[model samples]
Each structure stands twice: as structure tokens, then as C-alpha cells.
Target: MGESDLIHLDVVGLNPAIVKHEKQEKAEFSINRKCYSHLKKKTFATFVASKRISSLWHCCDEAFSDSLSIHRHVSNVHANEVDMLISAALDQMSNQSEADDSVQTSLNECQAKDASSWMPDISHLSEDKFSEGPGEVILYYRYCQIKEPRLIRDWQNELCSRLHLTGKVRVATEGINGTVGGTKTATSLYIKAMMAHPIFQVMQVEDFKTSDGGADCFPDLKVGVYKEIVPMGVDPDVISYKLAGTHLEPDEFHKEVQSLLNDGSSDSDTILLDCRNFYESKIGQFKNCLAPDIRKFSYFPDYVEKNLDLFRNKKVLMYCTGGIRCERGSAYLRSKNVCKEVYQLKGGIHKYLEKFPDGFYRGKLFVFDERYSISFNDDIISDCRYCGTPWDQYQLCSTDFCYQLVLSCTACRQKGLTACCPLCQVKGQTSSRSPTSGRVHKEECECTNSRPRIPTDTS
Candidate 1:
């Protein structure tokens, strides 16, 4: 067997017998006997003409771009030896055909084992190609009901992995929310494939918020089923998607914000209430919007209930990173009849920014990805959390276990100021010196650690 064959077996857990049979079948199907004979006649001349390693490397590189470069290098540099190896492969195939009974039994046993246990590390196959191209980033969400979230998640995960794309996909009974990054071609193809699915047929390519293609948008793909895509900690019985607020298109939202600013209408009656977490709105928000001082989406329900009087007889505008949170949040507000009208940016801040750069919305939009913020202009609306200087760069807490991000200036960062708060700073410092104290406590303001438990009858 070739080293490539051995690698296939090791990496993807392909049964050796099955791999060998498949290879033999493909070779037989693709190579015509007459053409093979003609190739044999021309092989020696071609090999002799391409005597230099550089010439051989170029030929292999051009012809076998999908396979291992090293394998191509060896095959081309040692053409005579490759011919011998081909003869041996044919002989081995003949011998393997006679042991079909034994191989069949082994194949059945291998098939019984879990396929997901041995995920192939495809980085070796496509890392070089990925590094060569600018990446396309897509952010989208849907709020339709899903009967089989897990199945959808698995299918999306496999497809994205094979396509060498990276992003996060959340599947919930209510819908799907995802953001992916890949080569422009790959992302375009992915959108087509997703739209073809019966469940997502209503989805339009125009609905997706795209970034100018770049190489460093995301690191890897992660897709899974979740109780709630946005985790707003509300019972499904309490709110329905049908009752959500009206979706204002980018241009419509822009006009409304402009009107409010132009009129100096910053009072409760004509309010733009930001539905996203405080951290997100701290960095960027629509001008004159009331961003609640909350840490998580779950708290928004209560924040709204407590501030019910503010929404009464008011036109409340809501938004988040994407529109998932607003779907339920606005619905809840409408159910209470707390506002005269509730309007949400159709595709959230992402879509709005695309249409109106440096418009009503100002500063960098914070995203929950490696590329922390996407900027539409040079506006700096925030300052370093520690130094209070005009800086908006985000840094994850230096405490090994603390994952909270803080805006820190260069001087503060250089002085080891990486914690989100004083307690976290001390915890980070203490934990570093004593590894046993590495367990990180949840931030005081955080309501719950994991996704809020799906509301139950008992509790």
C-alpha cells in the first residue's frame, strides 16, 4: 500500500480492505486498457525528458493539486520505482479479491463502530489552499420551527468540514443561526446548498450579511443543537415568533434613527431600546438608543418587565448581533402590550451597517468571533475599561480560566491588566501562582453558567 493509503486509514479510519477495493475499482473504471498501454509506451520518454527535480515537481504540482505534495514529489522523482509500485498494487489487488469472505466480515465490524469517533483531520488536505485565498464571511439566522435540529446540525457540520469552512452554527427547535467563513466560491456554494434544503428554501442570498472577503475571519467550524439559539431564558409558551415586532429594512431603520436624532427625540415615547448585552452596545450602537445595563440576553426579559412603564405609549426599537434575540424579545414585549409599536432591524446591526456606513450607527460592531469587532468607520465610541482611555480593542481576561473579554489599552495590557474586573484580576493573579486554584468562578452579574435550563412545569 502507498503511504497515502496508510494515511487515509490512520486519519479517517477507513478499513484497509475497503480502501484497497475502492482504489482498484476507481483505477479500473478510469483507466482504459488501450490508453494505459499507450501511456506505458510514452512513460519512459516523458520521465527521461523531465530529468530535473524542479521539472518533475512542477508537473506533479499542476496535475495533482488535490493530493499530498510530498507523495507527488516522490512519485514524480522516482518514476521507475512508481511503475514497479503500480505492478505491486495490481498484484496485491488480485490477492485481496481472493480473501473477500474474511475482509467482508472485518468491514461489517468496522461499520458497526461509530463514524464520528474518528473525524479526519482535513487540515493537511486544504490548509495550503485556504491560506492562498481571501475568505468570505457570512452571518445569518432564521426563526422557523425545526423538527430535527440535531440532524440539521450534523449535516451542516459535515458539509462545512468537507468544504474546509470555519464558523459556528446553532440549531434550536425555533430555528438556525450561523456565521461561517471560507473562500468566496465555497461560501457561495454553501449558500446554494443551504437554500436548496426544503427547510431553508425561503432563505435568500441577500438575507446573508457578508464581510469583504479576508483570510482571518474564523478558525474552525462548530455546529450543534441548542435549547435556544439566542438563549433569552423565556418559556416557549410565553412568546411566539408570529407575534414578534415588525422588521424594518436597513434604509427604513436609518431614516427612523436620523429622524429621532434630528428631532432630539431621546425621550421614552420615541425610544430605541437596544436588546443586546451591555458589552455589545458598549462598543457600538445606533445613536441615542437606550442600551440596557445587562450582561446576558436572559436578563432582557426582566429588564423589559421592570421598565414596562417606559415602553407604554412608546415606539420601541430593538436589535442584537443578529435578529434571533429580537424575535423572542420583541414578541414578549408585544405580548405585554407595553409598547404602541415595536420595530427591529431586519437583519440586526450587521445588515444595517452594510447599507449605511458611518450613518446613525457609530463605531465598531462587536462580534462573537475571533475577529472581535467589524468596523464601518474610524469612530471610537468606547474607552479602555481599565485605563478609561479612548480605546476599543478587546482582550480576553489573562486569568487562565476567566474567558471574559475586557477593553484594555496598550499600557494597561503591558502592566498585566487583563481581568474584566477587580475580583477577576485577583483570581487570575492567584490562579497563575497556584495552579490548583485554576477553577474560575462565574462573574457576579452572570445569572446562570450554562444555557438557561428549558423552563419546566415543576420549577
Candidate 2:
């Protein structure tokens, strides 16, 4: 985003502690600085020949233009090590599928249709091919606009087989921004089929860049119509956060925080707030971020509406994961008749950690999907329960029967490898070696760790 569209990082309560870390790391680029053009040049596109990403984009500073390069480094130099692991994972999935009849498709003729129009159920999808590795899927989008709706729904029903995906996509007038999962082949076919559509022939796309402008795109496939492609305009209680608006990078937001810190006559009057769920805020929050009786986005508004008198005339700063929530959240505060400057981090702590690792954010930031949690910038923010080492990377149980993600530290792993859980570990390890053994499927995979859980009754 351009500089004007930024929210102040300072409002997120990131300063001094964070600023110090960035300067030392030499990663201290101003998050608020509008280097859109400079960063854009590094903007690359690739139609990944086939979804065999050895290296997901690594945030290795600016040394590499993209993560693909990092993947290349790991794969080319350490191909043998990666291959062994991949083989092991795939074998595990194949064996697990044998045990679970549900994982395999048992189609009935009644559900079949020819030259058809039927929306497929999301529940029926599975990424079977991921037994080899984290399957790669590519989605074809038309420019920033999606004018076709009926076609998408039909595609969902007739096209997408029983493929698995992380389900969080919506279609809207603006465009699409949902995430799902599928096997490498399924995702690839879906993208190819999308381009074959005559209606979208003239459309521009950003997703294709992943393949370097080639036909070899996604490895798996599934395209469908969601409530909202991006799900931006939804109910007041949909996603977490009270606000939703354009975001500011960390740099610009930090400047504002400095002002707030200096504006106060004394520190006591400074009202701090942690505008996130108790679970999220607990991991790490600003020194003064408030922890109120709120869990979901819906209850957050009520908390401010009923208890705003405490900071009716004080400088109150708030923040959330992404800056989107503050858009709606801040508006609710305005209606309370409490006159105070409402501020939030543009992209929440995520942007802050990009530059300042050991900043105010103390632990791992929880995510909604299978990725579970990612480490904050520098320190081992959160501890691994088993070994007590700082670890935030989430792994689902490796057992195909139990694909639920569980937080595990380095020492917690069963065989010095990340699996879905101990159940998956027992299943994968004990199974007799198979032809497809160790090909894919870590068994430790899920959509997200924390979804938008609304407040029912927070006691």
C-alpha cells in the first residue's frame, strides 16, 4: 500500500524496545515509508511449473527477491535430505488411507451428473496427493474483479473432486481473497481449467506470476463460489476486530506511538489496550495493551461501549492482528461519546515483527489455519512445553486419522520430526513400509490454529 493508506505503528504501542532491535539488525527500514515502487520492482510472478516448492518464500531480509529463491537454494543443495523426509511423509499418508475408509472416495451414482450444474459440498474435498508433500494448488483470478458468479458455483460442483483445502474464501464486487487446500494435481488442474474458460481469457492475473508465466501452474485444483471471495464486507461479528480499514505499515504507525508517549504529562494518564483475543494477547502484548473480558470481535464493541468512561478523556491506543479490525472497532468507540484519539497498529504486530523482532510483542502470533503459529521476529517468544525451548511452529498430528494441529517444540517431536500429533506419530511409525511410504503427508496439517471465535459469554 502507498504511504497515505498507512496506519501509525506507534498507535500499536511499538517503540523504544522495538526500535532498538531494528537498528541493530539493520532491518530497520521504516515500515511507514512508502517504498511501494521500490518493493514493487522485486514484485515477481511465476506459474510454478508444478507445485514442488522446496523453499517457501523465506523472509531472508532483502538478500533474495522472493522466497522461491530460498526454496531453490535448499532443494538444489540439500535435495537428498528433503527427499528422504518427503518420501517418509508420503508413505505415512498412504498407509493411513488404508486404515481409514473415509479418506478414500466411495462415490454413489446418485451424486453424479453430466454436463452439469451443481455446487459441490466443501466437506467432500480432500487433498489425497499431499501424501507426497504439502500439495501445491494455484487459483486463477481475473484481474482485481470477479464478474462471473454462476460459472464459479458450477465449477465448484462439477469440477472440484473430493479435494481437501483450507476453507476461507469469499467472492465480492472488489475481488477474491480466500484460502483453501488441495493436492498438487488437483490445484494445478483447477487453475488450468479456469484459464480455459473463454469468459476469463482477457482477464489480467497476479497469481500466475508464481509459475513464471507458464502453463505448469498449481498441482491440485478446486474452484468455488464463497459467501465473499475475500469476505471483507460481512456481518459485524464475522472476523475478529472492531474495525476494518486500510492498513498502515509498521514504520508510520510507530511514529504516532512516539507522539502519544511524549504527549502525556505523566505516564499514569496513558491508557493502553490490547485489541485482540485473550489467547492472542496473552502470547504477547504491548506493555500497556488492555486485556478486557472479550474473546470474539462482537463482544469487543460492547466492552468499549459500556466501560469507556475509564478513558473518556485520556489518550487510548488499541491494536489487533491486522489493521482491518480497527476500522470497525474504532467507529464503535466514536459512538460512545468518549472523546479520545483512537489509534491502532496498521498491520498489528505482524508488521512490527517484520522490522523489530524482539519488540513489544513477546510470543508467537497465533494464526487461523494449519500453519498454526509462527515465531515473532527475533527471540524464542513462546516456549515449547516438552523441552521448554522457544517454539511457535505448529504441526498437525502426523496420523492421517488425526490431522489436528498441536503446538510442539523442537524437543517434543517423537523422532526428531514434526508430525500432526502423537496419534499420527504412532500410526506413521508403526505401519509396515509401503510402496508409497514416505512420499508426502506429514499428517500434521490443518487449516488454522485460531479462527474468528465470537464471544458467547465471557465470564
What TM-score does model 1 achieve against the real structure?
0.67
Candidate 2 — what's its lDDT? 0.44
For residues 120-155, write the lDDT of model 2, one tens digit per residue.
334444434533444542323332333455444444
Evaluate model 1: give its lDDT.
0.67
Q: What RMSD does each model have against the real structure?
A: 19.9, 22.5
* Predictions in order: lDDT: 0.67, 0.44
Q: Relative to the unseen true structure, what is the C-alpha lDDT of residue 50 in candidate 1, on a scale of 0 to 100?
A: 53
Per-residue CA lDDT of model 1 for 1-459, tens digit only, reads 443443223323433333333344424322223222323333443543353342122454454321144345655676566565455544564455454523312212322334342234444555555445667788888776666676677778877876678888998877888888888766776788777664565588887888864435677678888887778887665677767887777787787777777887435468887888776777787777778877788998898888888789998778877677888888899999868888888888888888788688877898877778888888888888677898878877776665677888999889988777666688768877876554645564232243122111110
Candidate 1 error regions (>4 Å): 1-131, 212-216, 265-268, 444-459
Best by lDDT: 1
True-vs-predicted CA distance for residue 17, candidate 2, Å: 60
